[model samples]
Target: MNVFSALRAFRELLPVLRPEWRGMLWSYLIGTASALSLAGLTVLTAWAVGHAVVERTPPGPLWWVLVIGLVLVRAVLTWREMDVSHALAYRVLARLRMALFDAYARSVPGRRREHSGYAATVAMDDIEKLEFFYAHTVAQLGASLTLFLASLVSASVLLPEAGLVVLVGGLVVASSALYRARAARRLGEQEQRERSALSTRIVDALGALREVLAYGLAPRIIAETDAATARAAAIARRHELLSQLVTAIRELVITAVVIGIIAVSSSAAGVLAEGAQARLSPAELPALVALALAGVAAISDATATLTRLHPLVAGAERVATGIGRAPVVSVPERPRPLPTGPLGLRFRDVSFAYEGRRPTLTSWSVELAPGEHVGLVGPSGSGKSTVIALAARLWDPLAGTIELVTPDGTGIPVAELDDAALRDAVALVDQEAVLFHGTVRDNLLRGCAPRSDADLTAVLERVGAAAWIGLDDELGEGGVRLSGGQRARLCLARALVRRPRILLVDEVTASLDPATEQAICDVIAGFPGTVLVASHRAQTLARLDRLVDVTDITGVTGVVPAGRTGGA
Candidate 1:
């Protein structure tokens, strides 16, 4: 990306960072002082050497005092700088992660066709990489430049010839940025793509490791992963080689500048062979060379720092793409209040499609009054789940509005409801419900803030799961070791505890035994509000008050998948 464009991406993260500006201020201040102190040490050492030589004296008490004091100051400043910057970086990372998660939740179920694995990488690793930029790279670069400028000014005061060389060398290094500017940006973009692809493959492989092993597909997956890794490696190698090539040129330029300064200064010292030149002493030569050498070395620092950030610039670009994504479902500026008492839902002529695919739902419509239980059935891909998604407002209809109607005839657009209110009004239980890594109670109350032990137990009983998931029981990741039926029951209990106004269940009993399926169906039937379930089993559909054929509403049709026959 261009510098302007790369910086623009950084701007997207400001909303999450704005609140922590106070901590950033402290970090920057400490870093600046540290950098300046280090720079000052070099100058002071050179000045001391010059005094010692010109005066024909070994040293003085003050010389040791100056060196010791500068070293101590540098140490203290460096420590403080690191301490403050990390404090800010960690805080920013935490906030960024939370914001990314919230964005995903708001855009999923309906908008889930987008790159989920890529987003996961952003929330996990890409955001973490930004710590270098947010914490050290940004502030350290600023401080280093400031110190370089100050050092240049001091050099000019002492020896104008040397100072000009330093100034010109700095400009040359800065101009070299133009050489690889376009290529670097392209490489950065390519690297970002490869990294995201690699991350996606890793996430997908791990998520489906069981199936991969069962089907003996490990070789194919391994080959694919290896290919992605090789591609990423190639991109990284090309990028690094280019950066190193530039750095080499930069070092050459600095060397040339240093040589030029030495020759010019030496000639000047010679001109003192007679009149004014005679006053210039040979004793000052080492000090002048030392100062020039130190100044030249700063060029290496500048070049190295820029090269280090080249990769991150690309990572930041990807993160910006994610953070900049416009959510498929938009929340209203002023959300309407939720319906009072039980909630009645209506979908009027809704239509939607995922990018290039044909319309998944075309001018579809449905209505469910409060306290009614409706089941959706049709062949696969007939948009059964889409209906439930619309009611939950996961995505807005392309052609119509999903509304919540009160008894008094008030129509509240689902989008107009507050997020918390919307969440409280709808609960979704899928066939493969995600159970997080935590205690049973933690997974049960993932986001419900006002949950109590009594409420938890009651919910468990409602789902016929009181026997398996005790408050302190360890369920492990994704509820490992739990029977399929137990897992379903826990998920069901989780949904039941929410007490939502509308419950959307997507084939929750597709793989369950008859007893477990009936038990789950009973729990859902007893729910006191609107319930919309999409299932292939005739038995499950028959349990509802009525069945709505997705084919009739979505203008698409299909035969039910054969696997669901056992449940019915």
Candidate 2:
């Protein structure tokens, strides 16, 4: 990306953190004060040295008091500035992290299986790299510019020629950033991609550890990860090398400016020029040199900060894009309230297609009246899950309206209905309904208000899980401690406990034993709420009030290969 685009990407992150502007402002002020104090100290010390050595006159008692006081004050301000700036950076990072998570939660699963590893890197690693940008860039740059200008004014007041030298040198140092700006940004982007790719592979391998070990693919994954790491390292090395070259050049320019300032100050003192009038005394020569050096050094530091931004540009872009991504599902400007009474689901000519693929549901239409039990039987990938997703409002349909029909026949479009109301009305229990790593009660009551043990016990008993598992029982990651059938029972219980008006089940019993499947089906059969089950099993389909053969409706063969016993 070009300079404007790179900067624009970084700028995008500011709004998410705008609420923390107070903290940022304090950080900036504290940091600026700290920088200015240090610069002032340098000038004061140079003045003392110049007067003492050149004129055999030591600084007065007032100068001693100012120097000693500044020293102590500078120490405290440095600590405070660091503390505030770091705190501000961390706060902003925390907010940014949450924003990224919110974005991912919305857009992911919609993107199918993209690089999960890359996402992780953005969330964790890439965000960490942004600390320098937040803590050091904006405030420090302001402080540097202010100091540079202050020094320039001081130098010019002392001697106009000295001021001119300072100005020219400052401009040269600042302009160095424009040199190879594109190269720095490109290398930074390259480094970011390589690192993210490497993280992706490593995370992928770790996640599929079972498959890797079972298939003896460890070596292959290792080789691939090693290669990715090497490539990333090489890119980083090149990036650093380029940075060093820039730094060297900048230092060379600063050195030249300092030399020029010393030469000019000498002439102003009438030492180098035979007939030149003395514009500055010999006692003030070191002070003039110090002012010029410090002024340009401030700008030099700012330039260095800009140069460092190149490494961060790519990561900033990723983070910005990730956090700035629009939600797949939009919240309505004026959400309509769900009509009171029994709620029925209706999908009228709904159409949706995934990215780079055929339409999953083409002009699809389905309806379920209150308390009606319907089963959708289709081939795998035959849009069964897509229908469930649309009904759940995970993603809006590309075309056509899906609404909830009220008792009075008022159809409230899902798009227009309040999200929380919809979620309360509809609960989905998919095949992979995961139990988080927590106590059973914690997972059961997650995000829920409150419930008594009696109420909890009643819900767990509905799915035949109360007998074995206590409310406080621990469930490992994905509830690995439980058998598939047991996990299914608990998952079903969790959904039922919500008392959702409309329950959407997606092959929840497909992998269960016949007995477990029957028990789970019994819970659904007993539920008074509206039910929609998508299953391939004959027994599972047989229990439903009615069945809709997807192929018959759409004139497309079943996407899932199953012995369809025909629609009920």
Candidate 3:
């Protein structure tokens, strides 16, 4: 993304950050005070030194008192500035994380194929990088500009020649930014990409650590991670080097300005002193030198900070890209209300294909009335799972609509219903239904509202998994200890608790034993709504009310009736 686009994305956080605006304002105020006070102290100390040297007299206690007081105030303001700004930034980070989560929940099983690892990286690491903005950008910009202006005005009052030189020198340092800004921006972009890739690889490796260990592929994963890290480091170093170069050039400009200002100020002071019939006094020498140096140094310091921040500013650009990514599916503004009770489903001419791929479905259609069970069986790569996904509206079909029907025959498009209503209307229990790293109760409650212990017990019993696990049993991450059948039953129990209007089971029974499979099928048979099963087992297919032959229709394949005997 271009700088403007990145900036626009950064501005999006303002709404969530509205509560922090007061804190941010205070931070900026404190920061400005701190910077100006420090500048003031520099000039005052210089003046005191010059006076003491020229007259051979020590500074009065009041002079020391003023300098010390300025120092104390500067320190206090600096502390306040960081404390308030960082507090505000962290709050914004939390808000951004919550927003991204909400976006994901609304857009999953996700519109396009995305890696779990990459999504995890976004949720964890990418959002953390945004702290740079909240902590530094707004307050620093305010503080830097405020100090520069204050210093410039002070120098002008001290001596016009000194002020002019400082102004010209500040402009020259700013000009260095123009020369290096483009290169820094480009390096920043490269560095951001490398960082993101490194994050993705690290997350992926960690998540698959078991697989790597099991297959003894640890060396390969390690090598890949090392390579990604190396690439990231190289890009980051380039960015750092460019920033240092900018700083050096800025310092060079400041040195030149200091020399010019001293030369002109000395000449002006001598000319004035001689005309006034007084020899040039040593007392004023250091004062003019300090005035010339102080303001110019402030400009250079501000310039250096801006240059150092260039990388972070660029990092924000990458974060903006993630935030600005378009949602795979567009949610309707005004959702259509779903059927009040158990509903039928129909797919009319529904067709879809992945981007840059041939169509998977074309002019295909199917219907299941309320409480009617249907089975969709297909060969590998056939659209059995795709059909189920489309019905769930994970992705909008490129053609036609999927509808839920009321008893009165009113049809509601799944896309038009609010996500909660649609979720209530259909449940998808896939083969890899993940159980989080928590108790069984936590995983089960995900399907519906939080349930009492009795409710959990009842669902577990109904799904025939209560005998194996309890509400308090830890599932470990991804249900590590649960066998295939146990995990499947637990997932089913989760779906059963919701009592959705339609249940879409995708090859969930494929890995279960005969007894476990029978138990799961019995639970499905007892459900009050439509049950659509995608499976290859004849026994599972035969249990359904009717068979839909996906092979006969475009975009629907691997489907056929279970012949009599049904046992395969």
Q: Among these predicted structures, which one has the highest TM-score?
A: 2
Which candidate, 2 or 3, has the higher lDDT? 2
Model 3, span 408-449: residue lDDT tens = 667788878888888877888998778889998888888587
Question: What is the full ranking by TM-score, best candidate first?
Answer: 2, 1, 3
RMSD of each: 4.4, 3.4, 4.0
Candidate 2: the clashing residue pairs are 379-559, 379-560, 380-559, 380-560
TM-score: the better of candidates 1 and 3: 1
lDDT by residue for model 1 over 457-541, one digit each (tens)? 8888888877755878888888886988888898888887778888889888998899998998888777888888899977676
For model 2, what is the alpha-carbon lDDT of residue 540?
Answer: 79
For candidate 1, the TM-score is 0.89
> Candidate 3: which pairs clash?
361-555, 377-558, 377-559, 378-558, 550-556
2 versus 3: better TM-score goes to: 2
Best-to-worst order by lDDT is 2, 1, 3
TM-score of each: 0.89, 0.92, 0.86
